[model samples]
Target: MTLTLVTGGTGHLGRDIVDRLVGDGHHVRLLARSPGARPDVEWAVGDLATGVGLSDALQDVDTVINAATYSPIARRGGVRPVDFFRSPSAVDVEGTERLLSLCQRQSIRHFLHVSIVGLDDATLPYARVKLAGERLVRASALSWSVVRAMPFYYLLDKMITSFAWLPLWPMPTTSFNPVDTSDVADHIVACAFDGIFGERTEIGGPQDISIAELGGQYRDARGLHRKILPVPMSEAKARGMGFVISRGARGRLTWADWLQHRYSVTHQAA
Candidate 1:
């Protein structure tokens, strides 16, 4: 059995990845901040900020999948201290660095770092740190692959349901190639098990849509009759208020997202 270690194994994407790995019969070890009732998973209690239990978590593991993020979405409208970005860097970047170092020491076979598509030149601190984490993974002595994915449907689900009673869905004009979390999880698991390394793959939905259009789809999917309101604003303004408002606001559309959308729509139109 392949002993696979998963960081942030309790999160939205992380949980899905864990479930898939466990279903596939891999000996799974999960790094979580708190202990919970995941009976099948070997839980290692550790806070990424403090680096607790990381070494124990990495012990005897053959591969690692990092699916953790310290974004405001995880906090759900609470005021994150300035250290929110710094702390994630410590965990997401520096913590991954530590894990890779340990992997080298243990001769762990593979490392998979989960990153976002626009992080290469993204202005958001979170995306930038994710990019740094990707860099650390690539530069490490251990063999690795970076999976850069687009925004997940969970963001859309949360937006529609959280404000279900609202008259209108307010979103920016920013576009995205939103992907299903399940597909992203499946792809990551496949990469981990197959020892695929040395390149990053940009995974997204089969189609792309503008935030306004995405809002409309979410509303329709949930059978809610809400107007999709697109607010025209500069990127800086959208990002600033988006941090306090919609998760869609903070995301800058990557060339990949843009081109993917263009190609998909053109194909559909033809």
Candidate 2:
């Protein structure tokens, strides 16, 4: 049985990954900063930003599911691009390098790094850092796999909140094929098994939709009448964010289905 250590094990995706791994009867360990205890899984108090408690976390662990992320989303509201490096990218880069060094010394069997769909060649700071981390993982002697999934549906709540006040929302026409966290966890757990693929595997939602369509779904689900007008993306934003979301292995949930089940009238029981 593979003893798996999951970084960011308390995060949105990390929780699902841990649950799935434990359900599959694997020994699961969590590497977190503090308050990492749970009912069944092992907890190692570790701060990726500072490289604390990592040795204890990795001890006797043959595999690592690195679900940790440092992106603009984690930052407080109203933070500008200039202040981004002050928070996410610097720590992201440093933490990945630290993790890689430890993995190399420990001879980890498989290292699966979770990345975004459009990050294959994205210029975005988070995407760039993830690409760098993936490169480091591949170059290392340890077996590695990079699984790229689309944005999660949870982010739509934030987007909706940002645009709720405006009668005519002016937002970038960024396209997405949002996948559910449960579906993403299922795929990642499967990839954690034997036969690791060092190459990237992409997963997205059942259908591709623009920001306007996503807004429409949220509006209709809420039973609130709202006009969602797409703002044309500037040349720079389009070229930078339109990193070409690949469609290879699509997930089962659609945006409409997810909304209906989560918030809309479709889920009478909910």
Candidate 3:
């Protein structure tokens, strides 16, 4: 069985990927900052920022999936925080560079880096960093695939809520090709073992939906009367709020704004 080492194995997406890898009969090793009990998989204590536990984490591993991400960005009052970019870069970019270097030394076969769609034009610092991280992977000699994914349904639920205890959603006018996290995990597994290599692929949901439409669907799903507000806010405002929110919220919303504005004109034409 192929031994796969997954960074950020405890995260929502990472856990799903690990679960699939384990179910497929592959030996999975998880690199995490904390030492916790994960009965199903082997856990290696490692901190990406300090380069701790990296070598041991990569030992005997065949492939590495960089699934690490910071907490959401949230506002305290109105000021956008700097921790949003700082923390992500520390873990996402610098930590990724270290991992890639290790992979190069170990002759790891495949390196799959997870990224968000429309990273090229994303104004948020997180996207910019992610874009930079992608470039770093491309520069490496190790076989690599940069998988860019659209927003997930879970993300929508986490981002908004309704008064009837339902999930109210807010979407930009820009279009989204939301893909299930499971689909993304499946695609990653495919790329890990059996697919074209050294190419970037954009993965999204089967159907494209606007932010407003997505919000409406969530409202309908819960059978709530909450209005799906399509606030015509500028990209700047959206991005600004992204920076000010919780670290986890920051990355997701920043990318959301970036995707919306980057595809706004194209979506309009379609």
Candidate 4:
């Protein structure tokens, strides 16, 4: 059995990747700061930001799927000027350089990286750091593949839910193609088994929907009759905000479908 190490294995996307890799008969090892009690796979208590336990995690590993990232802006609900300048580089950029250096030393066969879409022309600091990580993977000698994915549905969920208390919800009119994290996980696992192609694969959901439209859908899903206020953006900012992958592989579920599934499951559990 091939040994694979997954960074950020406890995160939203990382959890799905770990489950799929284990189901596919690969010996999965997860790198986490505070490891969970998942009995099926081995856990290495590590922090990518400080290069802690990464070498141990890479030992005897054939493949590495890097899903680790740090986004302070997202956690704070809005971007602050302080965080906007430097936040993601700690994990996504410098940590990647550290991980790649160790992977090279460990003679790892393949390195698979997960990144966001629209890094090419994005002005956002997070996207810029992700682009730097991509560059590092490309420059490395190890056989590698980078999977650039669209914004996930849950992110949109959080974005909309943040304004749940407001009578008039503010939403950007910028158009984007958001995908389900499950679909992105499937694509990543497929890339892992497809051998090291040393290419970038972009994946997204089916429709190109505006943020305001998506907010309306969220309102309908939650039975909230709040009015949506479209916030206008400058042409340059809009261009940076909106991204559509015309030729990339599309995911199965739409935003509405994801909403229904997520809420239904929550209702059932409740």
Candidate 5:
């Protein structure tokens, strides 16, 4: 039996990965900030940033699915790019470096990393750091598969909320194939089990929707009659957001489907 260790198993996508791997009968270990319990998950208290409690978590681990990240860029206000947890350089890049070093010593076979799509044309400080992290993983001796995912629908919710106080939603002209987090999780699980390494797979949603159109859909979904204002951006900046989908497992769920099903249900409950 293959023993798989999942970093950040407590996270949104991490938990789903844990369930998927365990359901497929893979022995799963979770690297968490503190010890926790689930039916099949073995918990190893560890810190990705500081490299503490790593050995205990990685002992005899065969494969690793690194899902850990520190992304606070959505509502970036008065934040310095390199200041502590506010930037991916501190948590994403450094933590991935620490985890990769551990995975190397443990002689881990496959390292499946979760990364965002626009890492190469990264305009944001976090995206650049994430790309840096990917470079490190690729440069390492461990066999690896990187899945570059699109902007999650949940992030769109934040984008809508941030403009809630304003009369008009100043939506970015940049487009995105906003995907369901679950779909991304499933793809990661597939990569983990398929034993395919040294491949970078990019996954995204069904249709490309500009931020303005997405905001319009969101406004309609939430019963908000707010005007959708398309905020024009520089071509260079639009290119940097990296929304164009080249290829991979396309998501079955659309933005409208997600809004009607997930967002509306959650928002109504709130």
Candidate 6:
């Protein structure tokens, strides 16, 4: 059996990848900072930030899917001025370097990196760090591929949910192609199986919708009617948030489709 190593296996996208891989009978090893009870997969306790237990995790691994990233600003729910300058060097940059070095030493067959779209046009400090990581993969001696994915719908759900209670919802006029995690996972798994090399792919949702429109859909799903205040931002800055997908594989789910399923489940449980 071919052993595959997955970094960030417990995350939103990572979990879906791991599940699909395991379901397909691929020998999967997950690199996680702490122990988890997800069944039918080997767990390697490791910290990407500290480079701890990475060597052990890379042992006998034929392929590596690096989905790990650190973003405190987004994870913590709000961005601060100080966070604007802070890059996720510890995990995304330095950790990628560490993993690639070990992959070379161990003669890993293929390396798959998960990234965000519009890094080149985006102005975010975090985008720069992730772009740097992609550069490392492209320049590495190991056979590598990069998959740039659009923002997930769950992320937008969180953003919209945060302000649903307000009398007026403030949203950027910028639009993005929000996708389902499962769709991105399916693409990653296919790439891994084919052992694709030197290829960069982008995946996004089926339609391009503005943030304000998405917010309105969310409010309607939850039965809330609130005024929408479109936040003014420069075109370049809005592009940094996410880009409209002119090309690449579009996901099967639309925002309205996802919203309907989301609230339908909630309503059923209630």
The candidate scoring highest on TM-score is 6
Would you estimate the TM-scores of all the predictions? Answer: 0.77, 0.88, 0.77, 0.92, 0.90, 0.93
Residue-by-residue lDDT tens digits, candidate 4, 93-160? 89999999999998999899998887788777777888899999989998899888998888778766
Model 5 C-alpha lDDT per residue in residues 1-270, reported as the tens digit of each score: 778999878877788788888888889999988877676788888888888898888899888999888777444422343543336465578888888888888888889999888677766667778888989888988888888898778776765676576777777877768788888888898887786787667889988888788888887777766777789877677767665654677988899988898666655411
Q: Could you tell me the lDDT of residue 245 within candidate 5?
A: 59
Q: List the residue pairs that clash in candidate 2.
A: none
Q: After superposition, how far is residue 170 of candidate 2 from its true place, in Å?
A: 2.1
TM-score of 1: 0.77
Quick one: ranking by lDDT, best first?
6, 4, 5, 2, 1, 3
Error of 4 at 183 (Å): 0.3
Clashes of 4: 0
Residues 1-270 of candidate 3: C-alpha lDDT, one tens digit per residue: 668899878876888899899899889889988866778788899988889999999888888888886544411211146744553577777888998998899999889988777665566676677778888888999998877776565565555442235334345665556656777788777777875677555666666556677666555444457656575657655544331111111122333443454345544210
lDDT scores of the candidates, listed in order: 0.70, 0.76, 0.68, 0.84, 0.79, 0.85
Off by over 4 Å in 5: 74-88, 266-270
Which candidate, 3 or 5, would have the higher lDDT against the true structure? 5
lDDT of each residue in 135-176, candidate 1, tens digit only: 888888888888877767666556445665788777778655
Off by over 4 Å in 1: 77-88, 160-170, 231-270
Stretches off by above 4 angstroms in model 2 are: 74-87, 172-174, 234-239, 265-270
lDDT of 3: 0.68
Q: After aligning candidate 1 to the native by TM-score, how far in Å is the CA of 25 from where it should be? A: 1.2
lDDT leader: 6
